[model samples]
Target: MPDVTTSVRRRAFLLWAVAALAYAVDLGTKLAVVAKLEGRTTVSVLGDWLVLRVQRNPGAAFGMGAATTIVFTLVATAVVVVVIRYSRRLASAPWAVAFGLLLGGALGNLTDRVFRAPGDFQGAVVDFIAVRDFSVMNLADWAITGGCALALLLSFRSSPMTGTAGASDAGAPGAREA
Candidate 1:
């Protein structure tokens, strides 16, 4: 078996690598969209199913909480801090990947909130990816959404209610065995 320290280091590396990749893609796409799509009409990529349109969102996902840009920035900062703190105890590879995606997504938007137009910590996030019948969003938004879904799946898989292996039910008040 791999030593605990080695395992942790490996997990940490995976987390950072995934986070970096996600962040890079998010930032790169935002830059490209801004450079190529700003001040222009939407460009269809999939027969109106998907299109590129430039927008600056000063709120959370789906254009909600537009007036709370500062609050969102602070929350994103807290998430990054929490992820870093929890990373030290990450023994599960899936959890590491989930947290990495969350971190990257959070940082990608946080970067805009801190450095983009309007002002510091109150700047708007650039969003472009638009679906015909859904909300317009960006790579970071997709990363965050995907990360949350993965994390929820992992949580369910590790829950005792799911009868996952190694999930102990011995401490339950009305425990029974098959």
Candidate 2:
């Protein structure tokens, strides 16, 4: 059997590694979009089905709650705190990745909120990717959306966040023998 300490460390490492990678990618892409496309006309990548148009959003996805940028910032900060505080107990690789994505995405948007424009903690997030009849978004948005979906799936599967086994092996071959 693997040592508990070693297992915990491995999970923690995975979580941090994923978080760092997501954060880096989100930051890099956002910066590139801002520098290259902020003032230019929309660049079509695949007709009108997909395009890149720089937009600074002070609201949540789909540009909702434009008047509550500070609230979003606070909520994102809370997510970061909760994820970091609960990471020590992670045992499942999927859960770790989910939380890591959540953390990294939160931090990515949070950085924009803190430093972008319109003052600290009320700054707009840079969004560039747009789909037909859909709101503009970014990599951070994708990460957060994916993380939430994965977490919900794991929860439905009754996967344990801190255990040697996940759900059960009841349906496995020879899981039960006479």
Model 2 segments beyond 4 Å from truth?
A: 163-178
TM-score of each: 0.88, 0.90
Error (Å) of candidate 2 at residue 72 is 0.3
Total residue pair clashes for candidate 1? 0
What are the RMSD figures for all models against the true structure?
3.9, 4.7
Best by TM-score: 2
Question: Candidate 1: which stretches are off by over 4 Å?
Answer: 159-178
Give the C-alpha lDDT of model 2. 0.88
TM-score of predicted model 2? 0.90
Among these predicted structures, which one has the highest lDDT?
A: 2
Q: Report how far residue 59 has shifted in candidate 2, in Å.
A: 0.7
